[model samples]
Target: MNKSTLALAVAVGVLAQQAGAAGFIEDSKASVSSRTMYFNNDNRDGGADQKETAEGLKFDYLSGFTQGTVGFGIDAQALVGIHLDGGKGHHPYPSSFFPSDSDGSAASEWSRASANVKARFSKTEAHLGGALQPNMPILVANDSRLLPQTFEGGTISSKEIDNVTFNVGQLEHAAGRASSNSTGLAVAGGTEESNQFRYAGADWKVTKDLTLQYYHANLKDYYKQDFLGLVHVWPIGTNQSFKTDLRYFDSSSDGKNGDAGYQFNNNGGFAKTPGEVDNKTWSAMFTYTLGGNAFLLGHQRVNDDGGFVYLNQGSVVNDNRRSEEAGGASFYLFTDSMINGFVRAGENTTFGQYSYDFAALGVPGLKASAAYLYGDNIKAKNGTSPDQSEWERDLRVDYTIQQGVLKGFGTTLRHGTYRGSDTGIASQDQTRLIFNYTYSFL
Candidate 1:
């Protein structure tokens, strides 16, 4: 049966159950989960180098559905982070994304929380209110925190058709996980109002092994973009498989980000031009797997007179996708890099990565990956030549037990090395580790 039919059946079952119950309480569900993490980082040389140790706690709570043809629900979260230690002031890349105290220390502690109300009907869902997070490559929030970042806005998702999912949203503001205030978003290298973001998208499953996705977004007066993606996964044999993911992006200036042939008003860092800006980028990655081992290869190229990449000034796209389709998303980590290891802004760059999974080796859940990125001969139209070379190496290993005393508990280790000159800034080596566990009581 098709997925839509399946959902219809489920909905009917739920409604039938609701009709026979003491309201919707018989079908209601609620739960609270906590996540704790210990983090440490060390950066060498440069005033931007980082050396820090910290701890974080996050609480996730959900309230079951309420009565009506449109069911109502609520979800709330709270996050608290504490500074365990910071060395020589610059550790934690102090000068980059975070502001340091006169003493060069990170936030002694920081916290943020949000709540959202959701309504569901048939195969559609809508949400509104304080919880801030709506992701798009052109407007992703920086959540490298032990706690996830959020945005304030309104969004709707619909799955009324058998093979399609549609989404639309309007984001009015954002609240950084470490900060409580709502801030407008702007592109990294432009001067304009970055608030009032908007987006829409569709996902269609064409076949059991193929899926197609399309998305369009605008960051207020900053930039407008469209994304086209195709993905396929096929099994080669009992123990072998192959998968491919390809994407294309087209970008142009919007409102203030667009030059009106007028001068002196900076739209972020982008300069006013006789005409608006246009950028195009395409990338594809494929992988083949056998047993517990896998090999991947991918390449991405950007063509534009200027830095063709667009990133939210305060958020970063370091090595993953801006969309939260899954727990671990895809990123143009190599397309453009994150400033301070998280922000992105640059031009003329090409990159690739390789990874492996250990689940087939009786490890239940374990995986590792390593990546290398390089940017060279960066030239811009009205901008100076960043005639320099920058490269980075990233490594990660994670494992989670399947069935044991510590089932569901997991640990991850990550490390990175970066070196560069010119254009936007400095260089360094960094490391991060997170270990945590989750439990459910419903």
Candidate 2:
């Protein structure tokens, strides 16, 4: 067993002895969530199309802290995914949506379980185990698929100060959204694993409507990244407001970053120093909200040196075989869209979105949004071909049952169309329909 697994076993054993403790048994909570998803992608090029439907069931148990100065608690999660439909030809090998069988077809089903031990002291809390899902400015756990990506790590968060919240963590391995196994961390094109990913950050709420964030992260022998973010809201009326959000990232090579088996693909775009991580990216977004309607606009620029970098284990080889199911990842950027990430070197992208809630029209649980992104001036490899460009359009609709026996049940539909010019990326159209429901048991 791995260290994290062993740790979880020991922690659970200790918790079982205290199972009858006053606070532990009284304040525990459990929940089960279900998601049914239909995913379809049509490749405009000669690539194979993917269409599949799957059902995901997730169970979570959160135990309250034991009664003491330094209280102890535990969180456990179990996930199961069942393949509802997808023929041989439609279920692609090495897919990002589901694990593959020995014959390269989609697996019938997959499941995994994880647990974490936590402690609380004053206004601070610490967690250690294999089910860490962090949502920070530097690393955002991906939950856009059937299951969420999880990490085996230890983290500490403290809100002892009045307006400042601090977070620090070190992660060793990650279980991909579609995989039943865990693997060490790596970048997009990296074949060798980096066992260490450390990060620290803080969020300061300066005023009631303003907040600032800063974070630094390093993947041992891979790359180091720093991020800065600012958000502010100006209230005009009870239901009208203007919001501004700014984000910046600076990334560079770390020890042995450009070596063989550790190369960075630069997101399949041009790189000044090939295989090396060197980048500076910034983005600005503005939003105006009135009643139930919102309008948002944003612009992002990637420096000329390289593409934006983030932790992606897609190319990692494990146990003498390629772990293709461990491929999907998310970054802290507006361009991290459903179809593509417009983060190539020298790329400048402008995007806008308009969304409205139907409550303004007497429907309280319906919403719709449409977004468009256009990117140009992407640096071509070797500076030989003309700069590439790409564009994407997305539409989404969501609704929930507000009353009756099915209250809290929700449905979402999303579609995206993408086209690019000589960028080595495929042109595709994608659509997803999802049904979500959660039940709480205490």
Candidate 3:
């Protein structure tokens, strides 16, 4: 068995011995969540369209720490995905949404389970397991599909100091949102697994209205990246406020990064050194909120040397198989929209969004948002073509039952349209409708 599996077994054994412990049984929590999604992607540029529907069920159990100086507990998760509908031609081969069977068609169902051993001491906590979902500035687990992605690794988070939080982790493998198997970490176009992704970061709340962050990460044999961020909020009145968020990243190649087996695709964009990673990106966003309405504006710039880089295992083929359809990822960026990420080399993008909550209009659980992004001056491959440009527009609406028997039931609808000029990226329109519900058991 793998190290994570063995660790889980040992932790479960310990839990069995301490099943009736005071705090462990008294403060435990359990929940089950269900999601049903209908996804439709229309390729405007002659590619085959993808239309599919699926249902995902997730069960989670979080045990409270045992009563002691150094307490121990466990977190377990089980997920199952059922393919409800997708015709032969609609279910694309090598899809990022569902696993394929022997005939290259969507599989009927798939399932996976994982557990984490956790310990708490004073004001710090540590977790070791295969069901880790981290949401730090350096990494964000993807959950835009029927199921959420997960990582296999160990993480330590501490808030021992007042108004300061520290985080460190080392991730070895990833299970994609639509996948059942785990694969080692790698970048785009990289076929060889790296197996080591280490990161350290800290968030400091300098004041009640201001916060600062810094983080550094390295994927062995791939790339190293550093991020710095600042956020501040100013309250103008009882129901008025303005916020500013600024972020910067510097990334460069690591050992064997430009080698044949460890190439970076630069998100299908132009790269100055071909397969090497060398990038500097920055973004700034401002938001103004008045009552229940909010407006946001942002600008992002990518250096002329290369496109941004992040950990992705989509292209890695493990053991002559494609890692059980392990594909799709998310990056921490304002432009990581529904259809496209305007992160090409030498690209400068400006974006804006408007959102409103219906509670101010007498509706308790309704919200809607509209966003638009325009990018220009994208470097072309080999400098042979004219500079490229792209634009995208997105619309989303969500509602939830605020009361009654299905109080927690929610529904969301999203649509996006993307177009590019002289860029290799595809022009497309995409839409998704999702239904979500959760039940808690203590």
Candidate 4:
């Protein structure tokens, strides 16, 4: 049966049983969220332009566990996207805003639903089926588009240790944020599908101001990766603090990653071994916050072996349908900019941002920020220029209703401009506006 029908069936069955159960109905919660987004991108270097406006409706339900030593519960989600506007060539092939139709146009509307069964013990929990979004350093499910990308997987999380938390799981497939169907996982370049993605990680709260993290992940026949992270926040005074964050990633080829069908594409950048995967990346960010002002400075460096890699399922296209989805990626790095990810081999990037909160001046729920990033010293596989460089600037403003009937309403505006050399990715100026609201229902 379809996901929607299945979700309805599950909801009805659980509610029917809850009439006689103790905790099922008493602890249940449901909510609906709505989002309207407008996107416009102009490629100054004669590249294709993108413009689209869409609306998204999301429903979420969380059921309380039944009384038992190992209580059982369920969670359900439904997502729908309405294609408000995308005229003709605005949303070209492989668009990220919405799913494409059979005739290469934006689909009128699309939807999907999910449900997960979960069990809870003293300090641990297990979840199976439906949606899995692990926000670890190695893998992050993208939620930047109309609908969030979701994975089909089983996960186990435990907080048995006093100051440590653990997460482990295996994902089989993923559904893109714009598509209604799921597909196997694979990085950029290779077309061969890998059905297994296993990961494990832990976070240790070393002290009141410091935390340490470690994670590892492996995609069958693709690549294996390990990550290490450290974060510390030092309070300076009233409403003042200094924060430091350091992250490192080490990745290499796995089973068949060096083979013909499972090779990586190095994100269309330089790969020392053509399709083979081999890279190391590290970044550091320091921030200072005082009163209503915050400033951040960071630097990132990509090793010379190859470009940093991550999962990008854009290669698995299938007739403008299910496959070739899942393109938006959010890596744990400062270089993940709006126009480009400065992850090319042997590249070094320096970036900074400054933000302010209007609440310090009596107006609450309003904020603005601006950031700049400059990258240089990039290397190419074909022995091109060694000093290739690029830069980007972004500005953002956001506000939410602090009181009144529209207390939950939110709006955000963002704009960015990027310029790069011929050896780098195309340059562009992009703008985005979003409005969001949420309401609880029981």
Candidate 5:
């Protein structure tokens, strides 16, 4: 173990020995969770077919703050991934589903552990060490595979003022879902290591149904970004309501991004200078909800300068052997569809979804939804000026035990199909079946 990991373990051990220290032991909680997943992908244009199955075991432990003006606590997680079935057909080929060996085969098993040390004072808190996962409009951790991505960072959050919250953080490294080691941050076309990522943001609740947000972030040598968002809800009656959401982002290249080894691929999309980061994006979404039914529609547009850019480890092919260690990441965007993100440069996308809950018809624990998205006016490379286009459709269903011994057992099914013009990605279909259950001990 490294210094950070060892220090976290020692801190937790010392804190656990002081079990009689008021809130520390009284509010402690533990849980064990399990997941079984089967994944299948069919490439319509004669690409490789993928089929695989995996099982995951996860354990969590959380301790409440001790009784004091400035209290201390700890949180720890253990994750284990077991490859149940993956034949030659399931080889790792440009995906993060499983760890890839020297021969491109999936590993039989992999595991990792993480911990966090936290301190609290009044309505504000500070956390340090690894296992940091932040869920904000600017950055989201991926949890779609056997394990969730984690970051090595420190963050501070304050809610001391009513209806206002503030957050700031600095991240040094990231560990992918399938790897055990941490690596420096980089984008999709750059292999240069950048260890500094700083961000600050705040949310203001101006009214009972309206909220506004702003955030600024810098990935040291890659790019800088700013985001603004607004949300409002209007009650239409006793059982109906309408919600509106608007978001905007502006991004530009940073220091090393103009140099060698620090170029961006733009996700294979069009770029004014081939490898520069220069873009602006905006989106609007509205939804109406009545009882157990919901209808949502949205539109998004990407400026003509370049494609949208976010943190991507797949571009780290020339790094310190950290390619597989930094694979999955998520960003907040309406067009982040199931199979494709649909954020190519100069692209305009329209999307909608309809969903229903079976509980409205006296059957609890079941829900279903379908969504579709279409993108047009996508810019092409080589200055061709031809407007390329693409589309995707997705369906999802979920059920959970309502009132039995397995009250929290859950099952989910999802399917998606993607097709595009000759200048875009090839056609494909994907499906996933997932089973999940959790047990708590206190």
Candidate 6:
């Protein structure tokens, strides 16, 4: 245990010894999940072809705090693993959250753990700590695997007004989902550090059917970002409803935009690039629901330059690593999902989706959905004007027994197919399946 962990344990131990104070743990929720994944790829782009299978086990716990209005809480997580089948040559990305070394090979096992301390009030809460994941549009901690990614930061949230909420945070470091070691800033060119990583936002309901949101973020020497979101819901009939969502982000702020310094383009020995990049990103998605069926179509675009900036490996003090961030479009960065946490740095994108709920079909807690996305005119900085195109198809099936011998048992299966013209990374196809169970212990 590190010094911080020891300090927390001591504090909790002391509190538990008080007159009427509760034990260190006020409440606890536990879960265990399993996954079987198959990944294969035939890259005609010179990288080694990959074909492998993996199995993983994850144990998660969310703990509550001791008694009192001015309470102190600690949240900790632990992940363990065993690599079923992956070789050095045909190594699959680790079954955990992050990618292994560029070599593609992975160790037989790996794990990650994180924790945080928080304080709360009637309508406001503040947390200052490390080893936690923050998931938001502007700065999302990628958590799409057996183990979720974590970051070192502090965040504050307040709901002191009617139909309105506010959030602000500052992050200084990031730890990938599969590793226990913490790393410095990751930006465009390389890793450096400074007084950066600050963000703020607000979400408000304007009426019965409309909601408005705004967000702003900065990454020291990296690019700064601003975003606006609007949503509306309308009832088409007794069983049909229409939902509309629109969002936009601005790529002008500190760093290259906020007057911090210059961004890297070709790496000509600190000489500086010629011009600056300003981005305007927007997306509109609409979903039509009828009984157990839902159909959705959406469009998202990223203007000239690139996508928003955040932490990366080996990067500190905020820098731009446009080396692989070929852009001109903006759909991948805004997609929120249960898999593949965040997909950014692409040009124009168009997507269509359909989902079915078994509840309307006589089964409760069962649902399935599939989506397809296509992007083109991707601008690459490596002098390769290949108007490369890529497409992805995803399917998910989930079933939870409404009532029976096993009242609340559940299972989920996900399938994905991705193929593209040498889009910098190897093209491939993948499939994943998961089995989960939850029991109440109150």
TM-score: which is higher, 2 or 4? Answer: 2
Residue 347 Cα positional deviation in candidate 3, in Å, after optimal superposition: 0.7
Better of 1 and 4 by TM-score: 4
- lDDT per residue for candidate 2 within 253-307, as digits (tens), equals 9999999999999989899899999999999999999999999999999999999
C-alpha positional error of residue 89 in candidate 4 after TM-score superposition, expressed in Å: 2.2
Superposed model 3: Cα runs more than 4 Å off: none
lDDT of 3 at 234: 99
Q: Give residue 422's error in model 4 in angstroms.
A: 1.6
Question: What is the C-alpha local distance difference test score of each model?
Answer: 0.58, 0.93, 0.92, 0.84, 0.85, 0.60
Candidate 1, which ten residues in sequence have the lowest lDDT sum?
A: 321-330
- Order of quality (TM-score): 2, 3, 5, 4, 6, 1
For model 3, residues 1-442, the per-residue Cα lDDT tens digits are 7776787688778878887889988889999999999999999999989999999999999999888898889999999999999866898888778888888889999999988999999999999999999998789888999999999989999999999999998999999987888899998899989888999999999999999999999999999999999999999998899999999999999999999889999878889899999999999999999999999999999998999998778889898865637878888899989988899899999999999999999998999999999999998977568899999999999999999999989999999999999788789999999999999988
TM-score of each model, paired residue for residue? 0.79, 0.98, 0.98, 0.94, 0.95, 0.79
* Model 5: per-residue Cα lDDT over 139-178, one tens digit each: 8887877788888878899999999999999887787887
TM-score of 2: 0.98
lDDT (10s digit) by residue, model 6, range 1-442: 5344465566546544542446335465666666555545545456665655555565666555556776666665666655566545775343233236545466557766666666667778776556656766676665455455566667888999989889998776665555555555445444344435888998899898999988888776666778888889998998899999898877653554323333532111111122233557678899999999999998877553544344444323323432111111112253543322123334577888999998997888999999988766555544345555567778889988878777777777877766666555455555555555555453
Please report how far candidate 4 places residue 207 from its true position, in Å.
0.8
**CA deviation > 4 Å runs, candidate 1:** 1-45, 88-104, 135-141, 189-193, 258-277, 309-350, 380-387, 421-424
Q: In angstroms, give how far residue 86 of model 1 lies from its true place.
A: 1.8
Stretches off by above 4 angstroms in model 6 are: 1-28, 31-46, 51-61, 92-104, 193-195, 256-277, 308-310, 314-346, 382-386, 404-409, 439-442
RMSD of each: 8.0, 1.0, 1.1, 2.8, 1.9, 5.5
Q: What number of clashing residue pairs does each candidate have, in the order they appear?
A: 23, 0, 0, 1, 0, 22
Task: Residues 121-199, candidate 4: write the lDDT tens digits.
Answer: 9999987766777788888888877778888777899999989999999887778888887777888766777878899
lDDT of 3: 0.92
- Residue pairs with colliding backbones in model 3 are none
